[model samples]
Target: MTTATETLLPGTDIVLEQLPKVSLHDHLDGGLRPQTIIDLAAGIGLELPASTAEELGAWFAEKSNSGSLVEYLKTFDITTAVMQTAEGLRRVAHEFVLDLAADGVIWGEIRWAPEQHQQKGLSLDEAVEAVQAGLDDGVAEARADGRTIRVGQLISAMRHADRGLEIAELAVRHRHAGVVGFDIAGAEAGFPAGRMRDAFDHLAQSFFPATVHAGEADGLDSIRGALLDGRALRLGHGVRLAEDIEISTENGTSYARLGELAEWIKDRRICLETSPSSNLQTGAIAQWGDEMVDHPLDLFYQLGFLVTVNTDNRLMSGTTLSRELALVSDAFGYDLDDVLTLQLNAASAAFLSVDDRETLTDAIIAGFEPFLDAEDAR
Candidate 1:
């Protein structure tokens, strides 16, 4: 929590934390509470890198900040180790929603690979059921606490594995239960979306939504594969799609020439789930620069691309949706309107139906109206 003295958004009194937000790219295994990790690891007889919850949290931040993707991903090894059982999965899922609600997330979609959680003899369906149960409990608990929120599962398939079809089926099977969409996570470099074409084809045929992790660890071709083969409705951390645009300046004026791919993305309004802190930690924006200011997010947004803010891995990046919004606003000199635009972008890109999206849009607008009105009076 930030003190009242700390300005979250520069030149404004609006606290980003109080604003209604949507989290489209947060991961389940990557957002565990450190104390929960310690307790779960203890019951499972797993070793931890840090003894105390505070120390463990710091360990994750330190490793993620090491500027190595391998080191950043290694933190997940500790979290996943403790999440092999039904109880572990349910508890984590429950807490994940509570944390989001505290951060003012009205809606969040948590993506995680089910194939990675079957170590303790739980089938994939069982794993999904346990997570859904926890999410349902979380929603009920939040309602009881007077905080309204909804969360859905984006059952992710590991790209390096061959269970894409299986995971896709699992997601569709649970669509009426709690599952809202399908995603392909894990390594994106060598394992392109084409490898999961059958699963994607099945999803397309079933009219299920999909989001693909591309343009983060890999480059343009990976993004191309995600769109063409995976039929992804959204691109997770599609920051590298900026590579396709050519920028030039004349007399202090700039012009951007978009390639056919970039043009299609912008014109069609394909959402780019950009997570600033996590993108920097994973070197996803290294080509642009080392700082948040160098992220292509500002350019993408300015060029009319559908850009949505996200917290890709909350624990690893030590961020919330509010923090990510604040960081981007600070880096790009954005105001409340900019922040709201990003939030609306997320709401529009959510895997819910058009009517549900409109309902969410209305909720977000209603939530922010009071604050915006207050700011106006001041």
Candidate 2:
């Protein structure tokens, strides 16, 4: 990104990337390294929009920042083009984890739709296996490097397609193999979770967790469908759920009146995977404003909703989890305590056993302590 990700903060001396973090909504396909894309494209004889790695990175950033979901999704064509083979998928998954470790992420969930990579005619299960193999390699490599990190797969089903049931079954079939949960992605406007009732029903019967991408291209109705119909434990970029909240001033104090949908989501402690830069780029919060401050992250947190910040598309949005947290912290004038709260929310929502979640929470609390000490000394 020509804008330079280092400019994410103005005067903060501490590099937040080194702080322990948890990533809930990262995508394996959306985060391929620019060099990997170029090399893979060459191997597959696919002509890229930009021949060089630097140029290709710029192309993705520009297209994603265009504020049109269709145009933004076009950038993925280049990434997925080179990721159809087993070798390609494995390498991408391995590197995706390494990048997260370098960014100081202790835990993460990498979501990708296996249905999209079938252009090479690989079966749905094989694709998931390939990615899992890569994730194992990534974990071993990180431990070897003395940087401990863990990641799991969240197999996604394309909402516009009819294979959600199959994909959901694949996720459940591999729950012990590597798959952590199920998600429905792509074109959220016309395709509501209600349309995938059969898939959700089957997943519910299997007792598998689901996260739905709602309130992104659509509004509160879609969010309602995700929670009610899909039984989502987490909302993917559910920023537009803010549409159901009414903020008014009473005696110079702000009070909120939440719609039934928002109230249910908040009362249930449903986690909102809010990605600031991506939300702005995808026009998820366009009705609010053109900047990151316009994001509903602070509002959701203040209203007691389980809000977790994320880097939805690291390559496209040119952001990391730390960058997203810093963006919101600046917008809301938050302290280190606020940052820890966000990470705690993510740790709790992670598709892990209770023991694992407690371990992760402990890690985050320990990691944030030194930063708090630094602030105190100053």
Candidate 3:
């Protein structure tokens, strides 16, 4: 059995690392270990910004904290460079699942662009198959070690490119294999989801789930585009959707007034995948403030915005699922119930079959029961 000693909750005795977690917005290339990068780069003869793994890790953090989305994306250039081969993709995908299991994640949706990995002569289908094989290996390995985990791939199309329709087809074709969803990622500021209307239309016709990257590098309009055009089942880092909300105080009581878009999203229970540390580093919440406490996560949670926590880029943010929950709990003074509610929200929003989702919910409840019982006993 895994003990919670790995992650002691801040200002509490709770061993948070033992709790089950679900990751919805982690990028495959964004979660590679520094050592893996060094090894892969060596194989590809790729020069790195830093030689040692420790310095490379530090380099990723520093570059991501540059506060410019374009600059932040440059870090992926290094990660993606070495991931162009079948072996590279498989190894990274396998390690990604193992790392998620180590962080107490019971389920995760790994998103990556297949078109980006075609540079080494592998077709789109070959890339997906290689990654799926690796994920299967990781799952078997984790289960052998007594950690239960399941993962799904979210095949992503680069928003800057014109392969949306093709990627959508690819994702749908691989639905029975390992792909559970489709997404549009990369350079979100200028490329609205509307540009891929045909792809979104096709996905809707095929009844495929999609989570669009929005409101992270852009504002409310981008979020609007994601919903109206992409028909997204979930929002990828939709933290900036809070910009449409107006907060006021009356008689010493604070209240939030939602705009039409914000009201629709809240009423519809559209999941907003919010990553606190990454949002801070990328200036996604700059208009509100410059700290975790200033993040609109608490506000959205309080307002019933279907908010779910995520580690957008674990390597870049130097974080884990447990760490994200701990940071948010400490910042917002959340209790065990609040934490469990967030996990349940994520479970409900996961891109799995209804039966599979129910099973996952059961597992979550089962896993958290002992901790809750201990808390109540205290």
Candidate 4:
């Protein structure tokens, strides 16, 4: 490991790296260590922007912060290039979990498109097995290190491609292995969830959980597809759903009106996995404004939508779940209790059984007790 001036953490005094958190939207390819990328690139005869890991890391941060999602995504070409082989896939997944554990993630759902990793001629089953092996090793390592961390694969299909149905079947087939859910990612605007109806249908028949990427690059129609056609249980970066909510004040009183889609999401308690900084960088919330305060997260949270803060991509976004929470708290004036509430929301929305969800919720509640008490005393 490179010696750095400071550790990435929430706070210096409180052992921020030890705080309990759950990550739902983290991506396996997006969280790879820059060193790994550099070495893997060298091994694969791939050229990189920088030779040193820190410089390469800086390059990614600079390039990603360009306020263009397309530019931000270009960085992933380097990562996915190296993840095609079994060793690369397994090591990347293993390291991804270890990094999450270091960032204090108690649980995470790592989503990556398997279709993108078939460059090395690995079959779908082979790719899944590689990632599963990595996840298993990571979990064992976490346990041995005195931290019980869990990770599940949210098998993702590319919306811009025609392999959704096949990927959905792949996820269902590997449900007992390490896969936990299904999702459609990549090219959100023109490629609505309806484009992958067959995949969603297959997943629905299998009773699998889906979380669609909507309301980020596209507007309400995309979200509608995710809900109606995709039957998504959760929304990935559904921050733009706030567009349907009308805000007004009359005679010093404030009220809000929710459109049909927003009403359904709220009434149904559908989880909105909001990533603050990443959204701003990717222009997902550009229509709202450039500032975090302009984000509708506070509005949705107050409106009773299941709002769970997440780090969409740790390396790409250069953020952790704790940092996301800290950023949200800074932008939305959330206290420790509010942080706990977000964790509780995530635990409830996890794609686990009712009993497991309840158990997870209780664990979250127990872990957050000190924060709750600290906030109460203040």
Model 4, span 2-85: residue lDDT tens = 132223223313334556778889888889899999888888899898999989888878888977777788888988999999
| Higher-scoring candidate on lDDT, 2 or 3 | 3
lDDT of each: 0.91, 0.90, 0.93, 0.86
Q: Please give the RMSD to the true structure for each candidate, in Å.
A: 1.5, 2.1, 1.6, 2.4
**What tens digits encode model 3's per-residue C-alpha lDDT throughout 1-378?**
335337666666777778898999999999999999999999989999999999999999999998777888989999999899999999999999999998889999999999999898999999999999999999999999999899999999999999999999999999999999999999998899999999999999999999999999999999999999999989999988988899899999998889999999999999999999999998888988998999999999999889999998999998898989989999999988888999999999999989999999999999989888988898
Clashing pairs in 4: none
Residue 235 CA displacement from its true place in model 1, Å:
0.2
Misplaced by over 4 Å in model 1 are 1-7
- Point out the higher-scoring one by lDDT: 3 or 4: 3
Query: Which regions of candidate 4 fall more than 4 Å away from where they truly are?
Result: 1-15, 374-378
Q: Please report the candidate that would top lDDT against the real structure.
A: 3
Show how many residue pairs clash in every candidate, following the order shown. Answer: 0, 0, 0, 0
Pitting candidate 1 against candidate 4, the one with the higher TM-score is 1
In order of TM-score, best first, we have: 3, 1, 2, 4
lDDT tens digits by residue: candidate 1, 64-147:
996666568877898999889999999999999999988889999999998999899999999999999899889899889999
TM-score of each: 0.97, 0.96, 0.98, 0.95
lDDT tens digits by residue: candidate 2, 1-378: 213434233345666776899999998889999999988888989988897888988888989998877778888888898889999999999999998998889999999999999899888889999999999999999989999799999999999999888898999999999899999998888999988899999999999999999999998889889988999999999999999999999899999999988999899889999888998998889999998778888899999999999998999987788778788888888777888899999999999999999999999999889877987899
Candidate 3, residue 122: lDDT: 99
